[model samples]
Target: MNPNPLKILVLYYSQHGGTQNLARQIARGIESVAGCEAVLRTVPKVSAVCEAVESDIPAAGAPYCSAEDLKTCAALALGSPTRFGNMAAAMKYFLDGTVAQWLGGELIGKPATVFTSAGSLHGGQESTLLTMMLPLLHHGMIISGVPFSEAALGQTRSGGTPYGASHMAGAEGRPELSSHEQQTAFAQGRRLAELAVKLAV
Candidate 1:
């Protein structure tokens, strides 16, 4: 193993665990690349109520993402559950808070990718992935998508898109990913990591 591996941040927001599952698979793919590491982090839920606040640390699952994580990561894999064809408020909120990073070019030239999960097959998975890319674009990060070269992208009937990795969670919000969805997500992550490695050199 390399003495210092490149860190790929897998940041996500999941309400019912579906998005989180996809994030985990993507992380697995990132780790498959030698001299690369996947750093999984999550954002807390947001609420309309002004007084609502999450504890400094989460009760379970990945810890809340920190600005330090963003600064140190060599690459990024962003994920969120579909919310009205867009990213969930929590993920959006987190991204919105990164103006400091954007202005300072903390993410400039870094490779990034997106993933999402949606209820129903037509639940706007692609739109969510695209919307998630907008912030990274503004940050000057190199965005990537799942290319057709990945067989699972062409074969997935449930969830998989050229925009990025995705999953059809069904109306009940199941977190289990189908074989194709898993493969596509893995391919996406591996591709992003490879790009980051090359870019770093």
Candidate 2:
């Protein structure tokens, strides 16, 4: 790793592994940068009736994210499943708790990105991605999208968009990410990581 590499936080909520899968790919993109690294973290679920209950740490996978994680990262890539063209409640709940960081301007001016998974070809991927950025914007974080310079955006018949990285989950989240969608995600990560490094300098 490059000394003093930019640390990009890959924070997300994944249910049934769909969003988690996307998170891994995005992390790969971040690590490709010479002076940047990806830190994978997750948020616990929220309950409707009862207060959210979670252990001190997740049983498996990356550690649970803390506000300190936000402070340390040079850039961010947030992910969540599509909930009626919006971010999942759990992810939103987590972001809502970041007002302390917002007040401190911790994430302001950081380059950031977003991604999502939808159950169908038209299942609100782009909108969910854009909505995910709203909180980040309020924190003054810069946003990035998949530009057309990536051919995958033009060629993908499945889930590729100018809004951000996305994947089609189909019913039960069956189908795998199409090649174009995968490439688009990798391209997004690479772009954001590169941007983070440039901005850091």
Candidate 3:
């Protein structure tokens, strides 16, 4: 491993904080590995009206992500709350701006993963994870998913998938992560970090 610590970017857009909870767990997993650090970031909500604007700094939670962050990360863990079976507009907007990174091949060989939260068990959790992976794929990132060997993947009745970590927030939109979901997120993050470290080596 390199002397300098690897930076794993944990980026997400969360409306009700469920996705944010997942992000934290993933970060924890990344940090569990030596010589790896997790950089947590979030995107601002988009306004339909062109005239609307948001403050540069978020009022709470993570700060907005920068293109430089994406360019420099050793690995990425992307997340979002499912929006009609897809990733939310805020995350899409942030990713759309990464064309410059794509052109530069800044992320070409980096490992990447995805996660999501939804309102129900059958909600678009998996679909949202897939859609989130599209941009990473375009950036030529090596995608990694949670494997079935993780105990949570096979046992979680809530929200665990081979695609990535997820949460079933139910109708009330709770932010608390279930134990199984937490383990799944940690496992995904650890896997991503481990892959990144090996690739960096």
Candidate 4:
């Protein structure tokens, strides 16, 4: 019998829609691969207090990420909006809650990638991407980044980095990803999904 299809989880936290848009483009890229699927998930916003006000299930958009989703995923593409050169608190909060999975080594062998969107060109896109990877690295995940072979990396005047996929949203909070940025993000997802498939069996 044929084994189950590979599933690449596209997990993200978006405050102003930029990160969400990037996640969608990456999902499209993941689905473009044969024998692979993209499971989109989101982390809810964190409150200043110890407990958040959100319900167990989100009212809209993708559902909150479950630990099972992380364990069962063939690959992972994590994204978040830039927040002072780091991933937003919400995403970090979600990851911090994954201690059980980390101790179990559930994601140790999975291929992973990172992505981010910033309000400005120099708004710590790369640093934000790097920060998002730290916890995954601690979980022993194999990290993958966009190779320079992708033309978008060279031509993108807006946002395209070898660290991962990125976007430059103007100060007005506009999230019009450039052709290069979008292509690079898609390529990242495709590469992650493909690598996950290769590692699955």
- Which scores higher on TM-score, 3 or 4? 3
Model 2 Cα shift for residue 184 (angstroms): 0.7
Q: Put down candidate 3 lDDT per residue, 104-126, tens digits, no spaces.
A: 99999999999999999999999
Candidate 2 on 102-192: residue-level lDDT in tens?
9999999999999988898999988899888899999999999889999999898888788888888889885367788789888889999
Ranking of models by TM-score: 1, 3, 2, 4
Write the residue-wise lDDT of candidate 1 on 1-201 in tens digits: 899999999999998888899999999999999999999999988877622766888899999999999999999999999999999998888899999999899999999999999999999998899989999999999999988999998788999999998989897889999999999999999999999999999
| lDDT for model 3 | 0.93
Show model 2 residue runs off by greater than 4 Å.
Answer: 48-52
How large an RMSD does model 2 have? Answer: 1.4
Clash tally for model 1: 0
Clashing pairs in 3: none
Candidate 4: which stretches are off by over 4 Å? Answer: 1-3, 49-52
Comparing candidate 2 with candidate 3, which one achieves the higher TM-score?
3
Candidate lDDT (C-alpha), each: 0.93, 0.88, 0.93, 0.90
Instruction: List, residue by residue over 1-201, the lDDT tens digit for candidate 4.
Output: 226678789999987778888898999999888888889999988886536456888778888888889988988999999999999998998899999999999999899999999999999999999888899999999999999999999998998899999989989887778899899989998999889878976
Poorly placed runs, candidate 3 (over 4 Å): 1-3, 49-51
- Model 4 scores what on Cα lDDT? 0.90
- TM of each candidate vs. truth: 0.97, 0.95, 0.96, 0.95
